[model samples]
Target: MPRHNSTEKRAARLVQEITGEPYTVCLNAVRARSLAPLAARGVPRNVLDEVEDELEDAYGLILDLPAGAAPGPVAFREPPVAGGRAVVRGEEP
Candidate 1:
């Protein structure tokens, strides 16, 4: 019999029983979860930078934009069309 049966061993055994996986596989999953956050730390900033560049190339004035944020407000309300007709540019209704 083993001299020590710690919490980690018990948790691994429980996970293996529930998932039908090997004890070593269940223990490795816990280790992987601990390192996930640091591995994906730069993901949010990278996505923001890409969106900022794309918006700047299109809309020039994104109103109420924060001091140092991407100009992501790319939509504006056009004047409502009369009789529910589509409004074409440079054409008088």
Candidate 2:
């Protein structure tokens, strides 16, 4: 079951009343508000691109992929090193 705080429950109720959408959809919409400010800022193209990438990761947004392409299993990756190279699991530095 999805956990919702009191504030989220109230917002979802209001949204459902206004739009007549299902509770789950309304709740998801309310949850998406976290990204609203960033989107409304009209950020520059380059900056918006970067921000969108980070927000997508943070918010678990679905990434656009090529048609008919299957997504691979999630893998853990090591943090970037000083020179900005990423280290995958089981690989030496």
Candidate 3:
């Protein structure tokens, strides 16, 4: 669950403005950004790394999944090249 804090809200909003992604995704991105700074501040590295890895899999880094997979398990890897148009929902056909 994301915190309902003003700073996080603002950062999520900025992410949405720049990326045009859904608010949920933007919020996830914002939350994923905290681990590095917190680790830098002397927080427990192992726990933060684990949680950060999960969060990144959820939103930040794309992983190559098998065809028809529901993005279940994750390994940090480059996404395979594929061609498809990202249709904007509000755009005319």
Candidate 4:
């Protein structure tokens, strides 16, 4: 279950404001469990459906490929090593 706190409440409110969505609908969106929780949380039926559709679209991207596919290595360059110490390559203080 998702944790509830002042920060979450504030965030939900902000989402509502930016999306022009009702506060309760935004809360429902956040509490969604396979799209059913949104219904119980008082989200308008049409908006809940739209939210579910968007969520599914985004979730699909999170797992676009089937398992057992060899994923590419994470790309990162190693920082400079000087006498077993990491050199501070960033801007000077």
Clashes of each: 0, 0, 0, 0
Model 4: residue 78 alpha-carbon error in angstroms: 45
Writing each residue's lDDT as its tens digit, candidate 3 over 6-43 gives 66666565544433345676565465553333333232
Of the two candidates 1 and 4, the one with more favorable TM-score, higher being better, is 4
Residue 91's lDDT within candidate 2 is: 23
TM-score of 3: 0.34
Q: Model 2: per-residue lDDT, tens digit, 1-93?
A: 657676666765554443333567656645665323322332223332333454355444432332443322333345455534333353224
The TM-score, computed over Cα atoms with residue i paired to residue i, of candidate 2 is 0.34
Query: Native-vs-model 1 lDDT?
Result: 0.34
lDDT tens digits, residues 1-93, model 4? 657655446545543443344567655545433334334433343443444455445433111222333322222223324423222232323
User: Cα lDDT for residue 90, model 1?
Assistant: 34
Q: Identify the candidate with maximal lDDT.
A: 2
Q: Kindly give the stretch of ten consecutive residues in candidate 2 with the minimal lDDT sum.
A: 35-44
Candidate 2 deviant stretches above 4 angstroms: 34-93
Per-residue lDDT of 1-93 in model 1, one digit per residue for the tens?
653346445544443343334466545433332212211322123222332343334422111223443322223223334434212233223
Superposed by TM-score, candidate 4 places the C-alpha of residue 7 at a distance from the truth, in angstroms, of: 2.0
The order by descending TM-score is 3, 2, 4, 1
Error of 4 at 5 (Å): 1.7
Poorly placed runs, candidate 1 (over 4 Å): 1-5, 34-93
Model 3: weakest 10-residue lDDT segment is: 71-80
User: Residue 82 in candidate 3 has what lDDT?
Assistant: 42
Q: Which candidate is the best by TM-score?
A: 3
- Report every candidate's CA lDDT: 0.34, 0.43, 0.41, 0.40
| TM-score of predicted structure 4 | 0.31
Of models 2 and 3, which has the larger TM-score?
3
